[model samples]
Target: MRRGGRERSMGFFEHLDEMRGTLIKSAIVFAIFAALIGYFMKEFNEVLLWPLHYVQAEKPTLVLELGTTTVMEGFNVVIQMCFLGGFILAAPFILFFVGQFVAPALTDHELRMVLPLVFMAGLLFLIGASFSFFLLVPSTIRVSIEINELLGYTLRWTPGSYYSLLTWLVLGVGAAFEFPLLIVLLVYMGVITTAFLRKYRRHAIVVIFIIAAVVTPTPDPVTQTLFAAPLYILFELAVFAGARVEKKRNERLRAP
Candidate 1:
């Protein structure tokens, strides 16, 4: 009995230590990537501008202008973009570390389900990011630029502002895309049922559009459509995925 009690005490400390170590390591890795990205800010900035380069190249005065009143203003903006770029690049690693640290206590079946969930979440995020970069980004920038021309306003975009808009939209949409995966996983774990999802379907549609409007970077209707349409489709996909999970759960319950 004493041995069992002592082991339990030690196990608690061990878990705490493990969690601390994981957190520290994750932070360190993020910092390292941030520094590296900072060092290569110009190169990454070019990557961010590639879409703009292609779409707006016809306009000679299309430049992202930064107001530099401080000695280090340029450096500060570059460093900021680099940090965001690094975070984007390191997202998978961060997610993996989180999974490693938190998921071991789950059952084997849970682990199996969760691995695929992680993979699907990552894939969906990538798709969302791509959508933002290729379609939404170009479309919004084009519209904004054209609107400036139509309103007879000279628009000078700053690099910091532009990249902030870009990164936020990309990451935000990517995170949003994981909603379906979350719903599916919840159903698979038997935490939520398909019936509940179906019952709340209309309410979810209203909420989904609200979320889409908030999450999308541009307030324009076209960009909102680009963001919300995919989200609605993903919600439908989640319903289907939830049904599969429900089917599996019912099968297990019916097993001898």
Candidate 2:
């Protein structure tokens, strides 16, 4: 084991014990959050159904309702809600616990770097999830409704399918928002440079649009642009940050 810039010998069994404790703590936190979400399942259901509500309000002529084909569907949806919501709510605490477990093994400089990146990752995820919930999901749903109506199809989504879509959009976009962090890490490790990012900027933009189109679930160019715009901005920001890291690296290389 290591702590405060000093190392202490520890046996394999001791490490296993520490890991078991961390896992137990993490599981406890997750269970608590899951129970809390289950207790407020009605409110949580309303939040998940907000996009449908908004669309109905906007297009008063259209009727939209979520259904369940099987008796167990409702129960499954509840479980899905509780698990996903619990994970989201407990994510920060879980990360903190993992950080605590690993902190003693990391040098001070490495710990400092990792801590900020973890925090930034959490913040970016929240931003992306909020953006998806408020903007992307609704826009995609609206466009989907419009397209289906154009094809003479009425909108009748099952609870399982609807919630599955919701989870995919929210979590997918949130994960995508971590792209900049990956880029920064690559730059730090000298795997890619800022110049390469700039050289391929246009290509990256095209790829971003493609990804946005695939992820947004609608063919509407406007919605796709909305999804891609922030991602493009993040890519640029990554390039800028990578440039700084490159400069610092170069300076260090020349120092001695």
Candidate 3:
């Protein structure tokens, strides 16, 4: 029995080593994907610009300005877009790789909970990203254009700056959308209870607004409200989900 216990302990270390190998493999895959994205930057840049282009329905051409100071600066913009595109494109695979790696350490019940949560997180993130791209970006753009026109300034945006801002906003929203998933996972792990979440609802509202303030690039309160409101709603949803999960767990325990 002592020998068996020692072997089990060694197996635990072996599992850790396997997890390390999985992470290393995932990193290598990401590097290769990044390289491929770098090679096809123009195509990716065009795709990224589509949201902006579609929004400017009246304008035949959207002009972006850059300093003629150095030709290399232009190439740098492409590289930036490539990296952004690569990360977005590789997100699903990255999640899958991470899931597969950690899944071995989780119990079957935990695995069932985690897999669904992972997929839901991915979906929610994409929805938030699309919302930012389709709604928030265009609104911000129109506001900027109107403000610039009033100031007698031409809308001379740099491609590098433009893509950077757009990508940042989209990714930020996407990451923010995972708030519910995180909360639910915490509840599942018993790190937090549904009652605790409910009790903190008021504080959460204030925190959500603060988060929104930090997230929004536009200084407008409207944009901040838009982001914050949805996040708060998601928080409520998470609380309800946790309550259900907790109730189900209690019922199982009480059963024969």
Candidate 4:
């Protein structure tokens, strides 16, 4: 069998071979990125510690220090930092390879739709990660410092714990920014419609606030609002885009 004269049907082993090749390429890309990050570990360390610096700049009186409690903690943090940085840097290449492997199965129309969504997903993730790094993380640290001061305790954090918090918050918010893509996919699949989204707009707002509160490290309403506001905008945009997609789908179905 053939698909649009672009892809030929493959046997079990052939599919496995293609998959293996894709994985191999992705691994190579990841490894190269990891090595590069490891080589520049000092710069990467500064980037990771930016939130701490940001907090310090805001409040000169606050004293915060990051230390390693265990003998291997620094080494472990370095390894974690390298891998995480490497994966982030290599993600686009890996996605491209995966797309290439799967493209044979998609027709031109599907490819067009999928490629744009993939690009948008990457863009949204970057935006979300930047927001967390530049704003949310610093605010969280400041809040934590204030709370500790209130309790008459000095602020000190382990490198492992700090990196864990940084990675978790950044990656989690980045992933959460893919929410609109999921919404669009559901709309395309006929699982939901623009009307449905609009009807549940109020409910969605409540859920969005809930997610923001949960995702944010502090109980500060400002931080939660900062997180939720963009999500709400994206939700609205999704509803609009879904309406357009729904219209196009209906027109296509009605054609000839």
Best by TM-score: 4
Across 1-256, the per-residue lDDT of candidate 4 in tens digits comes to 7566796778999999999999999999999999988998899889789898978988887667788888999999989988899999999999999999988888889888999999999999999999898888888887888888899897678999888889988998898888999998899889999999999999999999999988987898988998999999999999998989888888998999
Residue pairs in clash, model 2: none
Model 1 regions more than 4 Å off: 1-10, 58-72, 189-192, 195-203
TM-score, prediction 3: 0.81
What's each prediction's TM-score? 0.83, 0.95, 0.81, 0.96
Per-residue lDDT of candidate 1, residues 15-56 (tens digit):
899889888877878888888877776786688887678667
Query: Which scores better on TM-score, 1 or 4?
Result: 4
Query: Between candidates 1 and 3, which one is better according to lDDT?
Result: 1
How far out, in Å, is residue 3 in model 1?
A: 19
Model 3 steric clash total: 0
- Report the lDDT tens digits of candidate 3 across residue range 203-247: 999999998888888778887887888898889998999888878
Predictions in order: lDDT? 0.79, 0.90, 0.78, 0.90
Model 2 Cα shift for residue 223 (angstroms): 1.9
List model 2 lDDT by residue over 12-130, tens digit each: 89889989988999899999999988998899889889987887899988877788999999999999999989989989999998998888888887887899999999999999999
In angstroms, the error of model 3 at 30 is 2.4
**Runs with alpha carbons beyond 4 Å of true place in candidate 4:** none
